[model samples]
Target: MLGAGLLAAAGLPATRAAAATPASTSVLISGSLASYSTFESKWNYLYPWGDSHNGSALMVASSSNHNHVSLSGGVLTLTSTPYVGDGFNYHSGTVYAKQQVLVDSSWPSWEVSGDFQAPSAKGTWPAFWLTGVNSWPPESDILEFKGSATNWSNTYKNTSGAWSNTLTPISDPGAWHTYRAVLKKSGSSNVQIQYFIDGVLKGTHTGAGFVGQPMWLIIDYQMEGSSGSPGPTTTTYFRARNLYLARSSS
Candidate 1:
């Protein structure tokens, strides 16, 4: 049940980084937030690595392969099926935006929000997050389900590895919920990042040296690592919809 707050505007062209896709541009996002949902399409399958991201599941890259990635109605599902024998034991899905957001001083105050219905079953990890394109740190974990009833909001400050985490427990883990992040620059160097669940503010954190970093937005289903071991033997699912990124002048 998406609301009026699900921001959507015209889709635009964007460049890709190292992926096999086309290319991307660092456009100053202004006005109402627009949707640049493409490396070429709405989603790009897998990380540039094609599979596995510090997790037990192997990412399935083929868009035609519904066993790992499927789209029905408006929801995109990333599945993790164990014993698939696809070289990595468990097969899953990962997708990234073709668009990149520059986290510099000039970037307009932007917001990224999406509706996700993820598995809370142990060993099934799903994340809606952003990471640096050429480096690490300056990461904003919009919504992370570490195989629990708790939603973890995290922001990595810098390369030296300082981060702040806020855990919000879900009363109904299977129900659809909205998660969002709003970022505003604090001074000449850092940005104040705020976390939200169901339109309510959860916590606010500061990112160090975030002004110069550019990041790629990603959503993937990982198994076992932070979610613990001995995962579900049956197939697991992670679904997302009504995703948008908006910018404002302030």
Candidate 2:
């Protein structure tokens, strides 16, 4: 016969089980632009300022004469060459993705990634980042060399006050390395951003009031400013391959 205590405990109603959440499915949105025409199809040449952004004091992006942006051997190159144009000393390249990223119920997360071989010499500023298309304050820097041996991962949100940046050192800045960022919804109005280098996790931060907002993925090759004075006189390059965007599907 079973003990009375055991029988009494068995007789009690079992604890109610909690419902499980549905796992998200990752779907590819964009992949590598293998050719120049393909690159043009996926991205816009420059900002609304027309070949210039961020005050345009040092480098002005240009799409003319295959001077700044070009694709060769499956690798996209953004070159910075010394050019006396429009009161700017150097001409470089910048491109913005045609599709914007929106974190909503349909797509609660996103991923942007690329393999980069960027410059580390003085006055060289190359970055892969995302910013608001219609507003500011919601920005994420997946890879920013900042003219040093360190990569800077940053997230900006004015709603929460101030910004956040994490620096990761690289032994060789010109070597090829994978840079990735995953943006997932943390709550109804906030998002958690994670930065990865060479597929390894580097930094994770929260973006305040970033949910339901649309952001444009941008890659720019600039000169001077944060790097150092007297920009590089010789031609410099910012090379990237397999730049892509993915989303979480149902």
Worst 10 residues of 2 by lDDT: 12-21
Clashing pairs in model 2, backbone N/Cα/C closer than 3 A: none
Q: Could you give candidate 1's per-residue lDDT for residues 7-77 as a string of tens digits?
A: 22222223322235333333232221122232226457788555678887878657456677676666777
lDDT of 2 by residue, 77-111 (tens): 88888877667778778888888888877788898
TM-score of each model, in listed order = 0.80, 0.84
Best by lDDT: 2
Question: Which structure among the candidates has the greatest TM-score?
Answer: 2
Backbone clashes per model, in order?
A: 5, 0
Per-residue error at 122 for model 1, in Å?
Answer: 0.9
- Given candidate 1, what's the lDDT at residue 11? 28
